[model samples]
Target: MNRVKYIFFGILTFSVINLYPQINRVMGMGGLTYAITDIDYSLTPYNFGGNPAWIVVDEEETLLDITPNFQNSWGNYRRMYDSEGAINYGTAFKGVKRLSSKGTFVGFTSYNYEVVRNLYRTLRKDAYTGEAYYMIDTTQGDFRYTGPVVGLTYSWEMFNDLFIGVSGTYQITDGLKQVYTNAQSIFREVSINAGLAYRLSNDFVIASNIKYSDFQETIEAKDVNLLDVEVYNYKGDTYFIGKRGSSVTQKLNKKRFEYRGQVYVKPTEKLSFAIIGNIIPEIAKVLVPQNSLIDVEEVYTDFYTIDIQAKSQYQLFENTLLGLKVGYNNKNGWSNNSKKNLLMWDWNISDFYYGLGTSYKFDFIPMLIGAEFEISSIKADSSKYIDSRFTNVSASNNRIRVGAEYELFEDHFIRAGFNYGNDEVDVLYGGSDVKKLGVSAGFGFRLSSAIYVNANVQYRKVSTEYGGSLSRGGLSSFITLRLNTF
Candidate 1:
């Protein structure tokens, strides 16, 4: 009985968030530097916002970066609500500048366009909410989304051995479906973050950060064929009410808050370590339009998440470096019916990760090599109120990666990398028995004394088995140009 429950839980609560590839030159080397604690050699200045106060202490040079990227994927082995394929393309502009001896500023803006082909019954981007308050229909079609995002961050050394920073971002998107029951969607998001860091001594520093975000998505479906459109409003995993209409509208609103703290220690010039912890709380509400001015609340959900991680870096030798990382995360949430004032469903999930990596620079030649290994474990539990249905599940995954770079001559470099992973449970859709493989190659060129260019291309394949074997593959590429000014 427990095994059956676990299978169901895995099928219902699996999802993944797709993120754009980084535009840094180090990305060609399989991103090994991303896990290291050295701020001066990090991949991107934008990532410093994770500990916003680090902006003031970062010693990277001032520069402007322009990046253009594209990615595409297609497959048949997917979740019930997933799209058959997708294409994404975008461009971004980012900059970092030093205002004075004590102040630093960062800014970024980007535009993205996406096409989701042959999406299934779900009409919402997030279809796995335990509340089961989403809308669906029998028809499937392509959906298009386009949007622009803008953000700004500033850090200042407020006092001796103390630093403060603040950041804000805003994004808006518009989406439309191509076929009958042409659904239209509008999404808006806003976020703000603030943090402070203090140096307790020459060897230790502590930092804390707080963040808040608000999001809203409105979807409306309308048909011009003069035919009644059938829609299902789900109240649970297997139960839903049916309605026939020419048009319908719904809205989802979410608010979230996060608190984070970190401590960094440098006992010696050769070794450094950091420990970080985060807590997040979030709430979401589902509403249906009842009239021109009134809306009815259907479901309300409360969620909380906790995460902790430790990272360490050691210069094993004059030209060799070793890095280690360990992390754990837990998330739990519950949903209730607003009208009936009764609990509908609840779920909990936990994850653990371990990673080790090393890099070496050759003394006789202009070459660098790196290798990494990682392991992950996941567990989940869920319960539904109406049927008293409960489920529990667990899975594990392992990965290996290797990369190398060679300086062909002064100001020019070539890089290549390979990675493979095996999963007892698929990370994207929760299907069991999965294998993933990827290969990437890139080049970096110094166009002039103050300008540089970097480009990379990568291809990946995923194979999964449910009742039968299926495979999916995709290509992703990016080009970045940097202009440095003193």
Candidate 2:
């Protein structure tokens, strides 16, 4: 009995944190293979997986295997379960280059600027409110924690044809929520990302990547008012039923890292197609069973996914181009995550994006170059998030971004862009729109004929309601260097 109370206390009071059953239909869905970026080689913080499956041996070499079970419903269904974190982001870099007649090539290509923040801050309000609550569960002692976080990302070319990258991040001192438990506590951990690509043809490429995320936070027991009374003649049941207040703290952590990929091909000189997909096998679902349970084991899962996209670009005239892209993703369903099917009849939520863009140049306008106009729709299903509050809603994200670059000097340049995505999701409470803006500038200096240096700076803003109450704004920054621009 003491042990169960202690565990519940650890879960509820442990951290300033932060999912779930569904049969994993995809293999290699829960490994750290995709979240990392090859923005630099100096540091490797994350990876996306496509590697041969192998059990990552722990201290005792206990072969950790997660299975799916639908039995959470009065033991009717049982599925493999475990905590799985999956993430991925990618962009196409198209550049027009200068190739010489002497069998020499020299040109520039601009890929999506993946500026993993060296570090960023997250300021929040309302982290400490509501409950007259005493500890129901965790390891980190009492007192809600809240503060800003610092994140870093590194990406660089690997094996000439591959790009490997990782992100390393930690928070200052937050009583944020825990990963596996609801308790409050201080949290710290690292995640990994990795990627690989092969140029299939002059106008085609295929890549696979993975990412990792692991966080741990501790919680402590809280004291609350109890019913002071004696029942009937049973003297043995005379113990205090008030809330528990213990100094002992408990730890709740999460290890979510998985891999996925994208494949691109050009069917014509101006037409391209791609397929993108990722996996999230198991999301942690905690049950106290009774007030006596101490700690619970995290369940992992297996799942699969499929995504396809098509894009086309056309030269509208000299220095002007137009592009269009469309896509669709489908999940066949997994056993553990099959509960997602519960809401399948209610709404469909799959990660998908489609858009059209146009760019024009003004080479004749004294440094007043061209600009680009783009509009896109990003749609998703909340059930896959493995949560109740996030379920029941078919969310659609709509966005628009306009970008321009101007040369300050012959070699130095300045650029800026603004984008916005409104949450078209159906939720129980609020939140539907988000405004965003991006500003960036870069410098290019030539030290010699063969070596050059490029440095860039970018700032991004996200404006919306902070908690349920206060309205706030979030910002992110990035810096990059291209030592050898081919």
Best by TM-score: 1
Name the 10 consecutive residues with the lowest summed lDDT in model 1: 1-10
1-486 in candidate 2: lDDT tens per residue? 121111111111111100010101000111101111112100111111222110010011111111211100011011011011111122112111222211111111111111111111111111111111122322222223334344433333444444444444444444532222323345555555555555555566666667666655544322323322111110011211222323334344445656566665666654444455566432322111123457542222223345554545565565666666566654332213122232211122255666666666677653322223334443433322222222233456665555555566665555544444554421212334544444444444545544444433334443444232322222222222223334
Residue 56, candidate 1: C-alpha displacement in angstroms: 2.5
Candidate-wise lDDT, in order: 0.77, 0.33
Across 1-486, the per-residue lDDT of candidate 1 in tens digits comes to: 223332343234442222222334455666555333334444222242276776867635688888888889998766667788889899888888988776889888889899998988777765665454658887888889999999888998899988889889999999988677788888899999999889888778888899999999998888878677777878765778787788888899999999988888889988877788899999989988889899888889898999998777788998888988788999888888898998977878788999998888899999888888999998877687754777677889888888888999998999988889898865336566788888889999899989998888878888876656878888888888888973
TM-score of each: 0.92, 0.46
lDDT for model 2, please: 0.33
Model 1 pairs whose backbones collide: none
- Best candidate per lDDT, number? 1
RMSD in Å for all candidates = 3.0, 16.1
